[model samples]
Target chain A: MTRSAVSHADLTTLSAHKVRAAIREGAYGGHTAGLAAGKLQCNLAILPERYALDFLRFCQRNPKPCPIVGVSDTGNPHLPTLGSNIDIRTDVSKYRVFRNGALSEEISDISQVWADDLVTVALGCSFTFENALLRHQIPVRHIEDGKNVPMFRTNIDLVPAGQFSGKMVVTMRPIPQAQVAQAKEISSRFPQAHGAPIATGDPAQIGIADLSRPDWGDGVQIREGEVPVYWACGVTPQNVLLDAGLPLCITHSPGHMLIADVAEDAETTILTTP
Target chain B: MTRSAVSHADLTTLSAHKVRAAIREGAYGGHTAGLAAGKLQCNLAILPERYALDFLRFCQRNPKPCPIVGVSDTGNPHLPTLGSNIDIRTDVSKYRVFRNGALSEEISDISQVWADDLVTVALGCSFTFENALLRHQIPVRHIEDGKNVPMFRTNIDLVPAGQFSGKMVVTMRPIPQAQVAQAKEISSRFPQAHGAPIATGDPAQIGIADLSRPDWGDGVQIREGEVPVYWACGVTPQNVLLDAGLPLCITHSPGHMLIADVAEDAETTILTTP
Candidate 1:
């Protein structure tokens, strides 16, 4: 099996586990943006056990950007709460290795670098709720334009936890002026998936001086009749981790996610098993 | 002003600040159950700054029980988040002073015992949502019967945060079988007021051995055709704080509360001045 072989296969028809197995076998190393439909995909963060407590506290303090779905036991490569066979070392399609707050390497596997005191934290991603929005007939401009969602660093400071402290990052989506309330109502139900919009209308109020130029991801064009809505972005935790300047940290490359067995709309509860 | 004088002057109809002034002046020491209607009522938690961070973490972890509305800055007896002129040491109708986890005094004021290193936390109470339930024509059995809502210590352990770890405590209300969905919908709106019920159905499943006998509040009769619904109780935080054995702690006496400027039905935001 190879990366091209998996790509050649029916991408949307594969189960999450099958797709993960293919990724683990060096058969796939592509973005997981729309791969496994109806499955819960997660943003990954792996840090040393020493910072686990503080990181956990940080997630608790700021749930909008970091709704924790699963936490791997200390030094354990397998995540029991996300999926039964998830091996954090190889399950992700691609991994971004960070050292002292800077990206050092991009790899297909972290098996050789796995340490005995590493802890993996899986955060709920916006993709799940974005799918829900699309299902409800909400227009997602970025998806239609075939570009990554526009993201911005905001003046809104996330509640600081221990040594982890930074401003919140947000993703923007332009909604038809009349659909703003409906959009908020639908998204508010998914607190695990960034909940409701943090700000709307004037982006400058939140310190975003330019909507045409985002700090991360490709910027989307806002139509004349549309309003830009801001949601806390998953990039927040990653940014905070980088700012902390940890000796070693690992995260999934942007747009690459860990697809879990849990359904996208599954009731939010602590999973009894992986 | 004397208690009778304050009561006769329609002081209860005054704003939260004026009502609190009456309480501060030793004019009112009665239960705050129905006074200052439409205002947010909070349960109090005062502890030394050393334990404040851990307690905040605990509240963040177990939000269903400790839905934090306001947290005072270190040694600042005022809760600016809740209301202007809201002094924690004297605003509540009554205060229960605890020393080494044991109840040491029940007083109307704690000014003499206030410390420079103490942190005050104002948590949401069920009264806010119970009013909503009643407004929606939902019957609150305990309130109808003029009895205390039954509370039980469950076997469900809260996610531990530092030194604060204990079993969850819940309050029970019997709702009509058909109104379970309605109850859940209405209560879910008040996340700061414990959101929705943690469990609904046979109480034994969550480790409640007897429904007629409660560990804390007076047990009310469960009428025929009604199903028992349990909600995470505000008492859980106080109990957990007691169990932590801090050198000194202060909380509002049961039924007494610290009324705030925020409306009970107000939609809350992370930056809603709190």
Candidate 2:
């Protein structure tokens, strides 16, 4: 097949606002890893008001995997706090719709099926801290190899909230033994971005039975003398939400996130509004 | 008037479990400030399931003032996470019942009023860090003067969530100008206990106009060379809940609290389950 002439990759200099605008208008629908440069990108979750409280509590109890950056008001889709012109229904490049614990559809926009009672939740994504890691000379294995970061279901049980309960999910990165401390220190400063590594050195202790296979995302090679460092992944919430079998739920397609205007360093606390 | 011979003061040496047992049996119905010496004491808020979500969100957003230590399962009064045999309906020395947001009754226990729909919320109290401050020889003005800590409603707006919105409420402690940094450093370790000072020096920045008066609790004298340090108070959730005018709500009476089995230092995070 011939390569497409117009693509998100070609617009390297586009601002974060412009990227969001392009996604909103269906101009670009691919992954958004490097689209917005220094801005914070967020994982999106939308659900009905009836389940909003339990979901919010789930995030609160499990901050490691579900650090909430922005929560929309009940029945409101506008996340004005995260971005000046965010419409949850159409802001993301792609959305995975879930119904009764099953993936029902994959679409670029939900404006056609939008409801008045929906509440949107935005969680801090690791992409923010990954940028920080690179700037500090701490290499992220998957990013360097041009593949999705390996994510595994762990044995660490999440502190349950209402009907939301599950073990935590973690993402792994191969870091040189010497740079372990430095990488951990740099990432620890961004609490919104999952913070420091939850586990280092051993994968068996966290219940990852295999290195090459991951529950989500693709695995990368661990070079000689490098140790696997794990940080809580944002996928835990989406998985828990799906397992609850709610009547309706929506989430950003993996890697397709909502780009916020806030700089990565500007976001310090969770649950703060505009 | 002369005070009664038998009082909570005599139960100083009692274990936290024993103290709770006595409170449960209606043996002691006074303040809980000095009891349970090394254990954690908590502020209680009980509401119907319908209001639990919004209330929890309110706490999550305003963690400084409303740090939650334990949240009960819906329709359950047992806070086993805080204590092995804790019964939320009867654990505290005194209970204040509110209906339609108005004070309705003051009771020794809520066993009769307890409903299957009630969800209990436990907030971290200042008593934990005050004990730490005292151990470090940092003088607490209210303690030295033998009066209640001064509390004021600040102009700092709380991050609102679902019908729950209000200004922050803070407790003022007078500290020597030289020890302000030390006090902040020590208190910051206990995020569950409202953490470090939110405001120092002029009260006007946080909306307080006078040091001589307080919205709640008695005001104490600020000696020369001392500055007032304010901390987010546990009273915030109670105040906001009342203001929301819910159909039903219950809280620990002023100064009366739930004495938990957990040690003050054992608690590190907020919103653990019970």
Candidate 3:
């Protein structure tokens, strides 16, 4: 938990600030899964101010896949609401650079490509709900295998806004048939974390033809008695944005997220029943 | 419920499309209170395309006070997502024009002032929850009095986004002491409609001094054994944007709202508990 260079194995017990400090100091370079245990972690998308508005609209229109946790002011790298001294350029452990709709580079720091017109968008990641599922005795497949959650490009076309448009991308988890309801109920508590499963039992229903092959991230085994459950993924925005072929776009590498200081409860659309 | 130039007294039984037709044909010119019962109603805000992003971000950050139900594309009058063939230009019964942050004109139709760069935003209104409250046998002071719900500017500062910033505005309803919990529970189910009460019992806590005076709508009576309950109002954005001094901004006049084809459940953040 110390600010000293820490290994990925020790990240789960650390505070969000400590984890980010380690990442900033170049001490950690792994995916943020299970890190900063109960704190909010986000998917990052940095783009020009011009596309920021439309992108924001896209998020607004499709909130389940694009729950905005925090947004930085134009040309500002600091996200004060998410955490103090949270520099967007250096805090994330890994960054994906896209140019003209193609993967151009993978880097640990974006300080070199930072621009005044760039806007930082922090979206809710599935870490919260994954943690919730774990707490409820529901197993998460990718986490158990120490791999990134399997992601697939689906045929579900996102509601377009301005020039931003694309099919939705989803992350799959293998949930035992008996635990699916418990998983759904628990995950539904965190809408910012993509809420509950959009599809269960059949991956082909949402256009994923293969179980072992994924468009992004590592694929996990779906065992007997387990249903392949799909939740709208955070990688969706990045996938859609990349396909838009913008002159420039940057996002957190899949599974490598930005740790935020706020609790999951701080900014939730809490649905409660009487 | 028939759409043949229906009177306000008979409007509640009609569908959203019928209600919009009535308004579009210049038949309904009154506040939309109690109309289109059981359906979603929205507070409308029309502004130049330039300010839409900041305003949307403002809504993103402060969701309880500014839950957006539908947003029109730049220069597009149609909101197909909210309803079929719902034209933004003339569907609402009344429109308030703001010029450089000042109230300038109150008109029946905005077609004369509509421009290609203008964007229409529809936010959740309290009519849905008020109907819920009434159906639950809880008396709504404003509805019982046949007046617009009393609205007040609060001391609570909203989270700022871009050029949009201001204190939240809230509507006050005096609920009987015993039913306040039930009212809160019922209202919590409709986050698109300003969610649950932000404050109850004392108006002075939120900077309101007198119960007989409201900044916007008519004041209602608080009887013995009743407490004034408040919910974040849709007027906060209109109030803030008006204070921002935009050259041309239009909004639904106080108590008059746009009837959307969507149900209250369609666009909600949908908070749920196991």
Candidate 4:
């Protein structure tokens, strides 16, 4: 069960470059939450060029869920703008391989399957915004309880692009009713990190009949006086891509992400390389 | 030359739907600045499906310059999501037809060249953000001077996507140096409208050689104690599409835009049909 003697806590102290280097060398294959400290962590998707265009469109059309921080050139594995010395093939804790729209296997390194037409997409994760919420004294239930953010498939239809189409999926956090607006403002600052909650009160309005049972990730407690606030989740793209039954697809394991060198700063406004 | 009895200002008083109807009937072909009042005005690009995928990727990669508001399905002229009864063939003030990357001719309607493989791309215009600036009491030099906003070709190299690549084009507005930060915050609220100024003060930093001689549009004076603030322009995609010398391309004539039904509001975060 124990893959490394060095803990994730130790990885947090190291620079993002070092953390990525360790991952690339097969030394670290653990969840990336809170790792790389202040830098932005990204959810990863690797698809062939045939699906890349459509997938990119889907992300653009649905910005909140799939805020793209970096996209690698077709057949190229390095994300030069996202981080220094970045290599998509071997810099993740684990990659979930999908074939014909089904989970086929799990692997730590995807170098064996890397292809000339492969394209890598890096989407913003909620970790950055969650950190912001914590700093502002707002509760991120799952992080406090040590579980994945609860995600549900909703009746809300996403704007379809090409062969990719699916129902919108949202991650739910129960925020105190009074603090909902504050949470919205804080998260809104990071547009790349799934900015702001889409809906705040009843889940039934979005067609989520059950709050405890999520379609993806683990569920968390909704303390009294707190209401469920939903933000579009990164899993929506993966869900849609799987439904397309692409010949092959790969995504980072939940919570395990690519730690890019991009800092959470004022420069997000005038991003040139993104 | 007077083409119609109605002035551009006269049309601005009409609803967006009525304006599109008038343009569809070949009644008006002037610029669309301030038209539709509160609605989002859009720059237009129509291309064959063969080039659409790349073009879409190009917009997503360089979001600031080519902020996409709506896109039509291939060969479909109706932008159902942008406005009611919207027909790309005849909705705008004028259409500039390009052949092999060179300007071929100008027309009010594009029905003669309508093809099933054509895809329409709607980009966000600066008008929305300009209105925002005015509302916040910030100076928009061109507006005050009754001239087109000065636009320059910048040295900033946009992130290349597929076969689409080009330098960044910027629209310059002179703001009192003290209000630069205020302008940035106000415009930042409208991400769909190119978000915020990419740079301020030194035009040479982004490679604009002369403020008075703009590559496109009319220039306004930079008064004493005022600084030139530059924003990523919607003209960027058109420039790249032209440079590619594609076999066919159609765009909204400068200052002539497609009027869409989207309102400037909080819903930009949970964009449903964008």
* Residue-by-residue lDDT tens digits, candidate 2, B226-253: 9999999988888899999988999999
Native contact recovery (fnat) for each candidate is 0.00, 0.23, 0.31, 0.09
Clashing pairs in 4: B75-B116
Interface RMSD of each: 5.5, 3.7, 3.4, 3.0
Candidate 1 chain A has its poorest 10 consecutive residues by lDDT at A265-274
Candidate 1 vs candidate 3: which has greater DockQ? 3
Candidate 4's interface RMSD, please? 3.0
Candidates 1 and 4, the one with greater TM-score: 4
Candidate 4 Cα outliers beyond 4 Å, as residue runs? A1-5, A265-274, B1-5, B266-274
Please estimate how well model 1 matches the true structure, expressed as its whole-model Cα lDDT.
0.84
Please give the distance, in angstroms, between residue B229's alpha carbon in candidate 3 and its true position after superposition.
Answer: 2.5
Which prediction has the highest DockQ against the true structure?
Answer: 3
Best of the candidates, TM-score: 4
Report lDDT per candidate: 0.84, 0.84, 0.83, 0.84
Across residues B1-274, which tens digit of lDDT does each residue of candidate 3 receive?
A: 3335657886768888988888988877877876776668888889999998788878867778888777888899987767877888899988999998899999998999999999888888888888889889999988877788899998888878878888989999999999999999899867678888899987889998887899988989889999899999988988889878999999998778887766665434221110
lDDT tens string, model 1, B1-274? 5555455246657887788888888887778887788888988899997787567656755778987677666677876556878788888878999999899999989999999989788889999889999999999999998888899999988866557889999999999999989999899888779888999999889999999999998988888999999999999999999998899999999998888888887655233543
Model 2: lDDT to the true structure = 0.84
State in Å the error of residue A243, model 4: 1.2
TM-score of each: 0.79, 0.85, 0.91, 0.93
Error of 1 at B261 (Å): 4.4
Clashing pairs in 3: A270-B271, A271-B271, A271-B272
Question: Residue A10 error for model 2, in Å?
Answer: 7.7
Which residue pairs show collisions in model 1?
A: A2-A27, A3-A27, A80-A274, A83-A274, A84-A274
